[model samples]
Target: MPAAGSSLGKEVASSGDDLSKRLDRLEELVRSIAGDLRDVKQQQQGLGVAVLRLENRPKSPADNNAEVSANGVGATAEVA
Candidate 1:
């Protein structure tokens, strides 16, 4: 029932709204990825701190035995 010009105008407006919605969704996804990266960075820092502490601690005889095993050479394996 609408005039041809008005119908064309309505289609353009609808397409603009769809584009706006898609852009908003893309922005939301980018923000989510940034937040996830922050979380991963924090976890990596925490792990680094824990590893440093372990490395600085004095090693007991039990730890020495485990360290040898950690190098992939089991107690039963011959060493050069």
Candidate 2:
């Protein structure tokens, strides 16, 4: 019975060690993922700012020309 008890203790200790190692690996994985998410969030913010700038920018020369040509005065000016 003493030998059986010693074997049971060894098994318990082995399982506990395995559980600790797994927990450590899980913690490391979570930390790595969290870092990646932070980087992605920063990139997304930069993209958002760029999008906003594009949305609010002034029209190009082509757009201006189109607008002017839409009016009759622009064509008359070109002839003169």
Candidate 3:
């Protein structure tokens, strides 16, 4: 039969191994998340540029008059 101290030591060693593996898996997950975050930042930068370009574009008269015009006709025919 094994001594009580030796049995305790085996249990502690097995628990330590389990903890080490879990830590390694967590580290991998963290690295993957960091990469995803970098991609999101890059996409956000592109979207910001697109939004700025749209904002700087000239406004069309049609866009300005989405509602019925003062002449009581569809705005496009009135413009013509």
Cα error of candidate 1 at position 3, Å? 1.3
Model 2 scores a C-alpha lDDT of 0.94
lDDT at 13, model 2? 100
Candidate 2 to truth, TM: 0.74
Highest lDDT: give the candidate number. Answer: 1
Clashing pairs in 3: none
lDDT of the candidates, in the order given: 0.94, 0.94, 0.89
**lDDT (tens digit, per residue) of candidate 3 on 20-76:** 999999999999999999999999999999999999999888866654476556644
Model 3 lDDT vs. the true structure?
0.89
RMSD of each: 5.6, 4.8, 4.9
* TM-score (all chains, Cα) for each model: 0.74, 0.74, 0.67
| Candidate 2 ranges with C-alpha deviation above 4 Å | 65-80
Residue runs of model 1 more than 4 Å from their true location after superposition: 65-80
- State the displacement of the C-alpha of residue 61, model 2, in Å, after optimal TM-score superposition: 1.6
> RMSD, model 2, all Cα superposed?
4.8
